[model samples]
Target: MAAGAAPVTTESDCRCDVMAVTDRDCAGVTACPGDRGLLLVAPGGYRGRVRDPNLTRSAAGQLSPERRATDLRRLRTERFDVLIIGGGVTGAGAALDAASRGLKVALVEARDYAAGTSSRSSKLIHGGLRYLEQLEFHLVHEALTERGLLATRLAPHLVRPVPILVPLPAGESLRDLPARAFRRAYYGAGVATYDAFAGVFGGGRGMPLHRHLSREGARRIFPSLRADALAGAIRYYDGQVDDARLVVTLARTAASLGATVVTSTRAVGLIRQAREVTGVRVRDLEAAPGSPDAEFEVHARVVIGATGVWSDDMSRMLNDVGLRPGIRVRASKGVHLVVPRSAITGETGLILRTASSVLFVIPWGGHWIIGTTDTDWRLDRSHPAASARDIQYLLDQVNTVLDRPLTTADIEGVYAGLRPLLAGEADSTSKLSREHAVFEPMLGLLLVAGGKYTTYRVMASDVVDRAARRLGGVRPSRTADLPLLGADGYAAMWRDRADLARRHGVPVGVVEHLLERYGTLTRELLALIDADPLQASPLAGAPEYLAAEVTYAARAEGALHLEDVLTRRTRISFETTHRGLESAGHTAELMGAVLGWDAATREREVAHYRARVEAERESQLMPDDATADAARLGAPDVRGFAADRGVDGDSVELPTSSR
Candidate 1:
């Protein structure tokens, strides 16, 4: 056994090797590192089959344990058209775009898909309305266009319009009328412009137009508004999504289009051939440190780095190869708090202006998603910390207009995300440019940085286009009108949800839940429930989810770890009061059934999730950033993913983020 070789066990007569050449689970395109024959066994005993007994694949967009191993073997031998270095939305988008255009593609993430800023986004898809004030019209228009595609043409099942209210300031007396009217005019114009941009941009038709609401009228819709806090309100529409799910769908869609996607594999360094950048040197983070498969080199004609907050790290890879790097990316921190819907008696999401930035009180299922503070972050990017001060600041701002002010006790969960803003002379992170830029430090390497979540498709297209131009004979991006994994038959399925539930012998509510999460793919879950009636039972700790959903995530959604199941695959970590602790053991058992985790491994998974929750809780209690970040260090990240993995202010787990 040698380094960068696949693990093999000698048999009585022959040797088996992992290899990849087709969409099938176990086959090889090339010779094994040492073995004479390729007998690729999909990880976790796949035996050349998809876990779904009833479904078939034209290479289905399924990311499971089996595909992960098959793809890893492909990384060792296949020379790809493009290799993307991040698994966030942008990287996943690039993979989908390139692969759809019939180019060979491979993507590697040090952590799970969307394990960084992509999962921690504000979860909105709109042209940043505030950016209209900054006159970044082009950026806003571009984002609005992408928003339309995501909500309407692309991922209608995941991205949908949410009604948002812009609370207008009400004057205390006649003396303040002039200022109040002027303020109303300003916000009204902004909302109007936002709508106008959407309509003109193509995606705006999915949502209703902006409407002015009187104080009395606004209160009728949102009864929790403090009477004196606002005179009138302007209601507008913006899109929202399950950000992490979007990334996973993008990765899966890429795989369906013949891309090799693998997670927990970190891009340790660049693979250079003299003056030409060739590929990347990667380490399998999930592999045992001294194992043969721990480290490998992936050859790509061109490499696209969508590392976001970790963009500076791309520069360091250049320096490691004795080249001066030229990408400048800075990080902006945004913290969000989740509380029960009962805590905030609002039907429509609220957008309140702060001294520096706007705050959103978005409505989620049975909960209110409130956020976020925009400030510069210089600590631990893997686990950006939000202090007591950050939490207090948000409560203070939203309390000014709430009939009953929320307290720390009202908070159910807290998550802090970092935005990769383009470095500039702007005085604050909020003022920095949201526009993304692309740079090539060498002939074959491209670094893409500094874009908002809404415009990820555009950012991906630009970078991959650059790679395509260099590589030649590539088709233009086909993603603009392409529907994601479950979007195709979603509307029809939603229309028949009641029948779907009745036919599956479950409640309509259950069918609705699955439709929203998995779209037309809900059939797969229904099949699971049909096969195992017990699969229909709701998670005892979090009834919002079903046992079958966890099984599906493990079997088809590439959930290799517990955090992948609870935190990203589902929002149980933040949506549940127990922060997923009560459900951790149950989820681990469910995933273990698919990934072959033993009792000890299941216990380790539960303990890791428990420690992570406690660490985040303690970090939030701290009064300032330094103390908050230090407190987060109390728990080690799962799979040796320390906040800083062997570098000063550098993390192997690259992140992408923001508003």
Candidate 2:
């Protein structure tokens, strides 16, 4: 398990005796029974052998502190073929695409991975059904194709099929029957076309086709729907994912393929020579104050600006150096509200039309995520605040069809994200296109902006295709055929869920949850549970996640701060009614042990997290964007604090030593 060491596995290393059932019949007490017994395949079927519990301890895929340091050293010393700015899904995907195609790649994120628009997405991996109404068949086809690939071939563990119900307004009387019929025909044709596109591009993979339901059937499926709200409903299948996890997984997958993925790093300036972009000037946001290497430069043959909403700022940086800008990005803010499952009794998700954008009542694990309002935002790009007006707007729209309206008290979490809409003459943000455009604004520089989360893979493929032309002899994108880290052997692992539960001495539900989140990578967590059974216990306040997950975030997921573990690594921050406050202390302590934080550092981490929750609460009470942004700024950024405080005795210094 040493750094760069190959995992040792043999044909006789099968551990089938650990579990007595297959994933199908195990009910949750068995392990996967592969052809060669209970031997699990490592990611990408590397070596085609059973994975050693210790193999994950190596430098290959483990995003440990040691790996981070190693990657940082490489970023400073080595010249890469492509250096990507931004660590959201698009950037991460681009890095994976470039690295897999045999290009030397390095990726830097100003904040944590998916800490921007990527994680704040609606969490759907479907073709934009509304786009069909806009007559955007090409966009729909591309998105559907990528959705199919994600659910079937790529990140199967993180992406799965979800059914959505669209309710039709009820008629006033028998005399209004013709109008109702017309409404049904109109909506029904649109849905039928959606299914047709999926059939053609989705490869007929995952989830059932669309189906029409009577009022009784709709009510039966969603008893909480208002009796007068709908005469009938349409049910269709789409895919959903843990958006944050997908971004992190993409980074990890790229790292495993030899790309340098560094978080807590900011790209401050573009390094140019003559008229060609050469590299990037980056600052380690986590570095101690006045540290010599805190701000350094990385050399690369080409640099890509994949920053989402900050795309314009990146373009401005090039303009500052006299490079002509080829693209402009308009920022649109979308906010979502998370409430407990008791708020709405629905077996399937609900999608409703609004004045501008569509609103979705998605069924999360133990909550319903209802959102969002699309409005132009000219406030803070880092933390877009969800104002009281934004929350009220959502509540009003969703309340129109719900039997029991939700109040502010029912809201567990509120989040706002800014979309990088490609700037056009369109007056409204909702009218902007989701289609992306890639441009080489300058020699050796590629800029990609404006694409939906569902079509990220396509966007990545397209950007890399353009980059590949500049770097001659580079291979074409192979990501279409490359399954993400946890995707390999997922079908077999699912079958052995029961056996895995039994092997780990946990409930079937816990195993199932782990399987969905980590896929075949669940074994790494199982190893932690085996080493210390205490790790298998549910989190102190949030029972939805295991305590080991918090530790794993630090040990293997490159989590450098408490917020990264609580908010992005797991959904504890938003899923819990306490907004992760009650669990903050315990979660920080767990991460502290793995990241080598002292007692003061641990306490500081907890304090900062509490302040963040409070700031969000205060922001939610504000009436407008300006006031909300001001309120949100009341909580100082933890990384910013680190940078400002430097290595002074008053502040706890971030540990530079490897864990």
Positional deviation of residue 242's Cα in model 1 after best superposition, in angstroms: 0.5
Task: Work out the TM-score per prediction.
Answer: 0.90, 0.89
Cα lDDT tens digits for candidate 2, 1-659: 23333343553442111211112321212123333223343333222212133233122567889889989998999888888888889999998888777577899886788988888878899898999999999999998888888998888999999899989889899998998899888889998998888888885567678889999999999998998999999999899999999998988888766678898887767778988899888889889889999989999888888887766665665665677776688889999999999888989999999988799999888888998888999876777899999999999999999999889889998888888899999999999999898988789988888989988878888888888788776667778777788888889999999998998899989889998999988998989999999999889889889998998899989999888988899988888878899898889889988888999999999999999999999999999999999999888888773222113253222211000
Q: Candidate 2: what lDDT? A: 0.81
Tens digit per residue, CA lDDT, model 1, 563-585: 99899999988887788999998
Per-model CA lDDT versus the true structure? 0.82, 0.81
Off by over 4 Å in 1: 1-59, 320-322, 645-659
What stretches of model 2 exceed 4 Å from their correct place? 1-59, 641-659
Per-prediction RMSD in angstroms?
7.7, 8.4
